[model samples]
Target: MKKIALILLVFMASAACKTNPFTGKKMLNFYGNSQIFPTAFAQYDQFLNQNKVVETGKDAQMITNVGQRIASAAERWLSANGYPGYLKDYKWEYNLVQDETVNAWCMPGGKIVFYTGILPITQTETGVAVVMGHEVAHALADHGAQRMSAGTLQQLGAVAGNVAIKDERTRNTFNQAYGLGSTVGVMLPFSRSHETEADRIGLQIMAIAGYNPDEAANLWRRMKAKSGGQAPPEFMSTHPSNDTRINNLTAWAPMARQEAAKFGVTSFK
Candidate 1:
């Protein structure tokens, strides 16, 4: 049984490896991009049809404008990094919904929805760019794909472990091991890395889009205040803590500004 378990683990580890595009880190991602992209596109369309998508107007126009700038920045960054036409599969669209929820999200295929309540906090076009760039960075970095891959491995490991164990005590031990390995070795660090990468890429994108990267720090301050000090610690949540995020963004802003200078955006106001 021990030999069989060890062999299975070895196979799983060998079969699940991938490399993160931005960080160049070796990771375990079992899902293929070809499989995930089409499904994400279909889901995005379905969501647009079902939701109250805002039409042409001030708020709607602002969303679309900021989204386009960010999308252009992403395309430029990818192309410069030798991934030309990387965004060909993306059908980007942005909308502001009438809801009061202070929430926003960028879906897998570049669909973005910004709830009206978030606008008050965003305050200006640059602030909106900060939030939109961060959300868009998540999609570009393929964090969703990584998360799905991690979930698949966790499920498969549990099933294999259950099949290998005979006694209830051994089964429980196997289950615990599977859970700990999946959560600690796979999920937690991956999530934190994604958050940090998103902040880095998002700052660059916003700066290239002609929005001041400094706004990212202020945006997180607003997010923290809006949360009323009610969020879980950085380790316990998918997002970094407010202070950590703000500090990281502050440190990265000058670098982003430097990168933007190469793109003819010397000043962002």
Candidate 2:
């Protein structure tokens, strides 16, 4: 049983790998768009039905406008880079919901929601672009499916361990250590890497869309201030520290502009 589980895990990892065009890196994603997108779209629709989705307001318009620009920029980049039709399967939808949580998220297949509470932090269209690009980047990179794949492997490992270990005490000890080690040492870092990847990719796409990439770091600064500097240590947190993000975005802004220059977007809003 243990050998079979291990073989299955290895086979899935090898067979399910795909290359992400933006970063030119291979990703492990067991869930494909055909399997994930319909579920995501239905859930997004259900959530909008249950929530106060602002459909006819300045905020709603801005969300749609910015999201469209970001998505277009991403598409342009992909096509220019030889990945035309990469997003053909994506059903992009954006909505603004009346919620107090200072959060915005993009589901697989480009479903996005912006809570009203995040507007203050966004402050301007460019600020909103900063967030929109990041969310879209997550979708473009298939981060959701990759995380699910990682979680599946994590569970498979636990099961394999239990099957292989005959001593009950040793099995319990292995479970405890594996749980902590896998999360803190592997899972958290994996998530943090994804966040950082999104930041870089988002910066470039937002710049290509004619939004000032500099505002990406500024947005994070505002985010840090809003958090009152309250956050877990970098190693333990799923996302990178605010300071780290600010620094990375600051350094990457110039390069992002260079990327935009290729698209003839010399000035930004």
Alpha-carbon local distance difference test for all models: 0.82, 0.96
Root-mean-square deviation (CA) per prediction: 2.6, 0.7
Per-residue alpha-carbon lDDT of model 2 for 1-269, expressed as tens digits? Answer: 98899999899888776999988788988888999899989999999999999999899999999999999999999999999989999989999999999999999999999999999999999999999999999999999999999999999999999999999999999999999999999999999999999999999999999999999999999999999999989999999999999999999999999999999999999
Candidate 1 accuracy as TM-score: 0.88
lDDT of 1 by residue, 1-269 (tens): 55665676667668766665556777666666677778887787787778777787888899899999999988887788778866776778788887889888876667778988899889999999998998898888777877777676677667777877789998998788878877877678778888888889889999999999999999889989999989876665666788999999999999999989888999896
List residue ranges in candidate 2 displaced over 4 A.
none
Task: For candidate 2, give the lDDT of residue 186.
Answer: 91
Index of the highest-TM-score prediction: 2
Model 2, TM vs. native: 0.99
In model 1, which runs have C-alpha deviations exceeding 4 angstroms? 1-19
Give me the candidate number with maximum lDDT: 2
